[model samples]
Target: MKKVTVTALSVVIGVGLLAGCTTKNESSDPAAAGNASNGTKPKVVTITVRENTWGARKDNFIEAQKRLNEDLKAKNVQVNIDWWPGIDDDELVLQATAGKVADVFMNSSVDIGWERDGGLIRDIDWVKDSSVFKGVPDSYTNIMKYDGHYYGVIQDMDASPVFISRKALTGLGWTGEQIDGLKDRVDKGDFIFSDLVNLADDAKKKKLVKMGFAVEDKRFEGWNYAFGFYNYDADQNKMVLSPKVKDVYAFWSDSVKRGVISEGIGDIDTDKAAPMFVKGEIFAEFARTEFYQMMREANGMKDDIEGYNKWFKDNVVWIPVPSAEKGGKPASYSNPAMIFVGSKVDDEKMPYVQQLIEHVMDPDLQINHTIASGKLPVTPAAQEDARFKAMDFYKDHAYLVSFTRTRPAHPDYATFVQGFTLGVDAILTKGKSSEEAYELFKKEVKQNVPADHVIIQ
Candidate 1:
């Protein structure tokens, strides 16, 4: 692993300064050295960084940027962050292709594959030798690789579990013990996917909630959770579309028919759905662990965990999505946020960008960020950090890491997700049957993904 020592960093900074000064002839560039020797500040190399607000705690990024600037101050360089924050994926791609992107950016783990394939991001092959990343788990690092080349560094790990509102469940006359038992049953696969629909239907019929069940309005999320009932062949890197997908679609269609799910759910967005969940309008939805803070604030707990617990108790349940059948495996996804370097960064500025990444990847910073932001740590060392271990939230949900499975990091993964989303939209809005939707999905995948990259089951 490449170790970035104080001496080595100093030399690298010195070389950058010297390189900045040299123009035509070294001796003739007296003004450059004179400015440095006479205490005039050298030119500042401002490295812009753009990060998405989705699943991010903005304050953590701001704090990391401040720390990076503080470390670079001694080297007479500065990092100016041009924070363009939003969850618009298409906007990011447009900026990257137009060479208007920041030097470094944050993106979803799934984007690493196609972005690298499209030449929008640079391959950090040298990261394999970096001591700074040695403590990070391979599970996190491997997701950032495409065709054996590392393209990004994981920023954080989070589990997306199906969150059931405790208040709504209690309103439905569910006892505390019954709510606890529900989670246990789900974990044991005794409570299956069909059972979830039945419960939601019952809740709706009893007027316990306006909407008995809800998934994220996002197309990819909807498809991902629906298809998660099936198995992914990790050995073959193929997605096996389970025969149960037909049943899954039928379950949702029936839910819609019974008024268990929202009528205009196809048009619902996360912003609209989040508030509904907070207001007790929805009984259940799929959300990441990072979203707990939003719920806390909505309930007026405002960083008061104890207060939130007292108000809600065990009313809210966090469990893996139930299996399609009894005794079958339940599913959960670990979607890690990652940082990538833009392909547009010049060779001369690359070292500074690397230095900034090193500063951000510091063990202390990682631990602090995890504690402050409620995002999981990427490295085992950070997870074991004394400060991180002290958080009550981390202690309670840490076991989720063991069961989480990440989607395959294939170069054509983005195409598959898009096709899957389109198929799901057709089923929900166009009155298509599961068989018809799946056939259309297969056709779209075949057309969009390269033959060499396609993995059929």
Candidate 2:
């Protein structure tokens, strides 16, 4: 158990040249293998694991590590988990390129495909095939793969679903049944995006809230998922715009034109906007339950779990983001936290690494971590736990985990987001049509991203 700071540095290693640089480290000696198979004591080995700053506390990891080591005594393996506070994707990428990453680290699956193709992460499909990993569904495992090869394990995820202020609707003289009806429609795939706009517009007209809806433009990927727009074609290795892109663009543009969405929303940061949501300044917005904790804190209930739970029960309601038509798919997307084995790990330590990852993915450990961190559990067994089921927030949103979609696993994903955001803003504020916005999107991607990397259509 160590704490290390990964400082900002400029470094780039050519992943193309480093591809296939890793080697399997299984013991060649039959005597050693036989001894371990027979439960004979072998020399103890330690593997490194890294956890990000945001998810769970240091004490939680330390306690988990202690328990894990106790269980690993029979296998003669141990883990040294390094807690890296405030290390983001940029720093992690730099560490990977420099061959200085830990054996395993928690990261977002959004970058797994990029990292795999860049030769920064180890091929972990073999670990997925092991008995310890067989319980994880293919839907979750598929997101961690690149070119049909697994590079990571999905640890925890939260769908970016829309949250509505029940208090605001109630203030508009709506009954509980009416509010529940809306939620039911949303859940049953009958409440389309147009219905959302109409509800928000009604709230706006009645002055129930200052803004009817809000979305942070910087993280525009959620809307794409809600709209069922997958931008990348894996078969062709090209970035293809969804045929319904214009319809989604028009939906936002119309929301703005009708004053349901206010001006300057492009600058709305989640940190600031989340409080607005709690204060009932906006009727609905995309968020995770983790932010409901923030809302509780904003309402002066930081440590009062009981009060917070009561507040959440009375004021908040969540639903999958509505789609284009009634009976059409209403979907949510996940940016799942993942466990990745670094490419630089030596072959000899692979056995220990597997054991460490298996322990980390254990159902009890996953349940404990999600409870401590306030994230949705990834494992089916963990989801069925009574503690997880007891929380109204988790129970209400748990269904979202079943159908959560992931973003395109390309290295230039940031580029695609930026390009899409630019196009969207043009339609919303610049008075450009969807066709014009499409051109702007194409130009932005072409100028900044590698040409061969994406086929913009």
- The numbered model that scores best in TM-score is 2
**Residue by residue across 1-457, what tens digits does model 2's lDDT show?**
0111234344544243223332333212222332344566556454455545565634444555666566665665444554433355655555566665667677677776666655557887676667765666666867877777878877777776788889878977889988878767876778888887888899889888888877643556666766767777777656765556776687777877789876577776667777888788889887665666667767888788788898777887777878767777777776677778888777787766766666666667767777677787777777778888888887777777667777667767767777888888887778787778777877888887777878655
Q: Please identify model 2 stretches exceeding 4 Å from their true place.
A: 1-42, 57-61, 75-86, 93-98, 132-137, 171-173
Error of 1 at 253 (Å): 3.2
Give per-residue CA lDDT, model 1, range 235-346, as digits (tens): 5555444555555566656666777765477555555666677777777776666666667776777778778766545557766777776886666676677788888787
Q: List the global CA lDDT of all models.
A: 0.64, 0.69
- Which residue pairs overlap in candidate 2's backbone? 25-347
- TM-score for candidate 1: 0.74
For all predicted structures, in order, the TM-scores are 0.74, 0.85
RMSD each, Å: 9.2, 6.5
